[model samples]
Target: MILQDFIAINEKGIYCLYGDFYLDPKEPVATAVISHAHADHAVSGNRDVYCTEATSAFMQLRYGKNAALTFHILGWQQQINIGGVEVSFLPAGHMLGSAMVLMVYQGVRYLYTGDFKLQPDATCEPIQFCQADVLITESTFADPNTAHPDAGLEIKKLADIDINIMLGAYGLGKSQRLIQLINQHVPDKTILVPHKIWPLNAIYEKFGYQLGNYQIYSRKLMKEQRQFVYIVPPFTFDSYIRATGVKRLFASGWKNLQVNDKDTLYISDHADWNDILKAIEQVSPKEAWTLHGDGNALKQHFDGKLPVKIMN
Candidate 1:
């Protein structure tokens, strides 16, 4: 088994390390293993793609029939072998098709955290931790000061507000979490979703989450609003929320986002500072490397604890 520290953003491939081989210059790799259906990781132009069924369908719609070279629908706890690399997909707690891969190549296990969250998002499965020989984890929300507060309390406060509550989040992970929260807490009323976000709601439904009767944003419905809570993407707030007579609120990892009379919920799609540590500790990895948000900060916390690579 051999390992190297070289992650490069190649023009030939979406993102890859230097030594690793890529298939096509235009559509590199006959088989590409994807973690989720987020536009960033699951780019168009790949031939044969190996991702979850949820992501494969999403790719088909966005990239056409030939978007994926092939399909390898990997579910949770399922393991497959690819050229001596024993790969297993685990729940990442990010979205419907999100997964964290644990690969064992020549007896050395490498865990890759492809955007995971530990706190139970209202809409998805809780994050799963596994032991590995080496761990490569995401640090999207690695800073301790940026840790989120109790979601249950914040949501209750928002729902109790005087005006209609509209939470601004992305269409993927954040939207589902909000829908789950609203469904669990306020299942009595009709939940409304912007048309663009309807696609994601369908994916969540495939995962067996019951989000109750969701409809498109309509003027008629807004006029009849009685303490209704609407979940939407951030762009929808600017384009539609104001017209609907709903007060705007934001839920994202970014700090100090601009908003008026709006409360910001610090929910994130990646593991927090403590969760990151616990993930590595649980694995008891022989070596560790960090990528994504504030990796060095996460590395500093694990000093003298494990062999870690922060960046360079």
Candidate 2:
């Protein structure tokens, strides 16, 4: 069977024609096989949503009553039938509950990798791969020149700062991961989390991933503490751009987010070019399909080796 005929990208998102379900649809649809609970991938209003248990919890936490009409929670590697197609979830390693959707129909397998990473993270499950006939992957950091440094080493950079740090990070997955990294690498420094992110931390803890030694943020704590890291969401971080008496830093993989030369922390959750190459090699698909970022580099890299298609 042809791969595109099984699943193809449309105006909404990647649609699985055989299963009659959308994979991370842009808008609400009858059925959505969510890869994760990130706002971009897991939207509210779907009639039936299939995802990991943690992903369901996060969606409920973020969207409340509007999460979804029905949630079909699946454990890692657990397979279910959806419209005559067999579907399963595998760890994506990008964040807690993140997964790569694997669908099989008529003995042909297609793997849809959402945002994923190969970097070792203490807070979430590591990525796993399976052989497939067609591999659909995200190329967020697919440039051959782009390589993510060791995350543990990057977190250690915080140890050098003697004063309080105003660190900006995404409130969901990124913030939780940062909390654990700081606790593990720079044990001496205190980690302060804002109200916006505290709930997410609790959710992570509920899933049995212990995030060591962090307190809810307070002005009193900020005034009394020294050598502490104040983690805030982007909006709060931006508002405090000119705040005095603390060192400013943003934790991200994107170079553009690192505005300060001396205070940049290059910790990223997405896979770099090498990691993407490694995933493709492990999956060993007959053909490769790329999405989410520019796939020209991948296409060129596999020009004579493998057939690579850039999905719009």
Of the candidates shown, which would achieve the greatest TM-score relative to the real structure?
2
lDDT of 1: 0.68
Q: lDDT per model, in order?
A: 0.68, 0.91
Over 4 Å off in model 2, which ranges? Answer: none
Specify the poorest-scoring 10-residue window by lDDT in model 2: 1-10
lDDT of 2 by residue, 27-82 (tens): 99999999988899998999999999999999999999899999999999999999
Error of 1 at 205 (Å): 1.7
Model 1 C-alpha lDDT per residue in residues 12-115, reported as the tens digit of each score: 44333432432122344655678778876777766656677777877776678667667778888788876556677887888767888777665767777778
Error of 2 at 305 (Å): 0.8
Candidate 1 segments whose C-alpha is farther than 4 A from its true place? 5-28, 187-190, 240-245, 258-262
